[model samples]
Target: MSALPNTHEVLLRNLNLVEGRPALLGVSDAGLLPECPVPGLAMTEHAGLWQSLAGDTVWEGCYGYEPEPSQGGSYDTVVVFLPKARAEFELRLALARYLAAPGAVLLVIGEKKEGIAGAIKQFSAVAGDVVKVDSARHCQVWSGRNVDALSRFRLADWLDWSRVDCAGVELSVAGLPGVFSVGRLDDGTRLLLETLAESPLTADRVLDFACGAGVIGAWLHGFRRVSGGSPIRVDGIEVQAQAVFSARQTYLNAGVSGDIFAADGLAAIKESWPAVVSNPPFHSGVKTDTSMTEQFLSQVARHLAPGGELRLVANSFLPYEALIRRYVGPVEKLAQNRRFTVYRAVRKTLG
Candidate 1:
């Protein structure tokens, strides 16, 4: 039972959500990602939301664009959803400013507590005043005309976030402004990475699921390279291009050979000789989002060969042991602190 029960099912019923030939920006789980057989023309976000949330069946669009494809659309209107971050919403609106033609309209929809008003003010340059859509379910819609447009020049603030290093490694992290644990390492994540210092996937292909800023990935790579173990390779899977970019920089900075994909790389992951590692994402806003982590647990078991392991760190209080038990056998706790718990599970049999 998902929070958005039939999230996929509901998405299918909303085929009429999009209208005419407008290019849609800020399409995430709630807005777009067609559940209906017929896909929308286009979407924008950290990465390919349509493919994961719904499926590849609705693949009728351009995706994963950097400086994203804002301009060049013949679209008379651009629908912009107020994303989670005010700063991110600002950049997205700034990008859309150039895309909308003169007199064109920008439609924004979001939850009231998510700060949609601040977005309206940020985009005032390429627009007029605020116009709210129907207010239902605590969500509101608003619009503005392209009366004016302004360059934020704050592009780097939302895009070029970094982290302060502790321990032995000082790695760079790229993050979109509004993302969870943006611009730094999570307390739990840092604890997990520090504990896993003794374990390295020597000469094995390693996948860092939900890799943010490539912290865990680079940490492992650096230690293994120094230990002189078979030159182990790294691969990361993240849903955000910004996070992917930061992870890629970690690889580049390490001068190590690895792949970091913005796509949902964890979904298709199937490696016979590999080690799967993660500090999986388990929360969305104030709510718990176990979908990605559950999928990651299942996939980790599927990807590892005989004796292969899935090492993970999670909040100590979460009932992850049950989820881990569902996919892996003989699950064992490795370590624990007041805030976090680490586990090592072996892929005993084919699920």
Candidate 2:
């Protein structure tokens, strides 16, 4: 296994603080905790991490993309690996608090650049008595004590929703912290929506890959309703549990008929669709990582119905045209502006 991240390493530096059963929250790295007599629970919002740890012998409990805490406030030690989004820390803190027992050793570990210091400050306001436990590898581990508190965690409570106009249709978009373009419609997505609005696709069923907050899918549904396009069944695939939850909320509130689920890229999808639309993500954390999107480009052809098309929006600078042409079929640039470009590729039909 690769070496533990600096934040996780700092968390290990103060392993002595662990009490009874332990709970790890927002821990992106798997296998960080050693095997204990009582196997601990490891949970993450990232589907990739959960997939790695699930069914493993070390952790008795593993949950991914689940908002509810399965083990109620039972662990005496709770460690929260800080997330990059400032508001997301509160959501993780709420989860950590719900999982930890009264007087549990609550540890928050993260790199300085990820805003660990600010996280502790905000955590101190709620639970109080926050302290720095350890510092190493440009990361710090902070500790706090959990209060005796029990309130059912409602994912809806954390969502921030807003009404935005896309394709001349007013649609509701809800997003949790860390979800892409949470409160506002991003330029790329807006551009894609406008282009699609002008010439709506003929697909009866649509799959929104990497759909964040279901904006693309929801807007399409509303536009079709007003403009008399073919009715579409929307299916969204998101990698983050938070994004999945938010996307579901967006669809629910907007009266958009859709299903949104968490998955690592396109791994969970099997059925082919008439059209696949996306503003596919290309970042892992704050870093630009294109492997996932490239993988999607590579495998999407198999998931397309005969003569089906893939419509997507990406940054203007990304080199996805070659990959799309190589994998799907002939590619056409539909729209382009200063920051983003929209492309469409159709799967070739057999004679």
Model 2, 1-351: lDDT tens digits are 789778777767777877888888777766575633446888887777777776677675455324445677778888888887887888788877777777787888888888877787878976778888778899888778886445567667777878898767998788788788888988999999988987788887899999988998888889889987777788999888888888888888878877886788776678889899989887877899889899999889888998899998999999999999988898999999989999999987533
Q: How many backbone clashes does candidate 2 have?
A: 0
lDDT of each: 0.64, 0.81
Off by over 4 Å in 1: 1-20, 29-41, 46-48, 52-60, 64-73, 148-158, 161-164, 199-203, 226-230, 349-351
Pairs that collide, model 2: none
Q: Estimate each model's TM-score.
A: 0.80, 0.94
Number of clashing pairs per prediction, in order = 3, 0
TM-score of model 2 (CA atoms):
0.94
Write candidate 1's Cα lDDT for 1-351 as tens digits: 234322223323333443445555666554444333343345545465645533445443444334333444344566676666676676667655655565666777667787766666766645777666456556666667756654333334455647546456566665665555777778887777766665544436777788877777777766665556666777888886556665776578677567887766455555544577888877775588887787767666766777787788998988889888888767888778898988887777763
Cα displacement (Å) at residue 222, model 2: 0.6
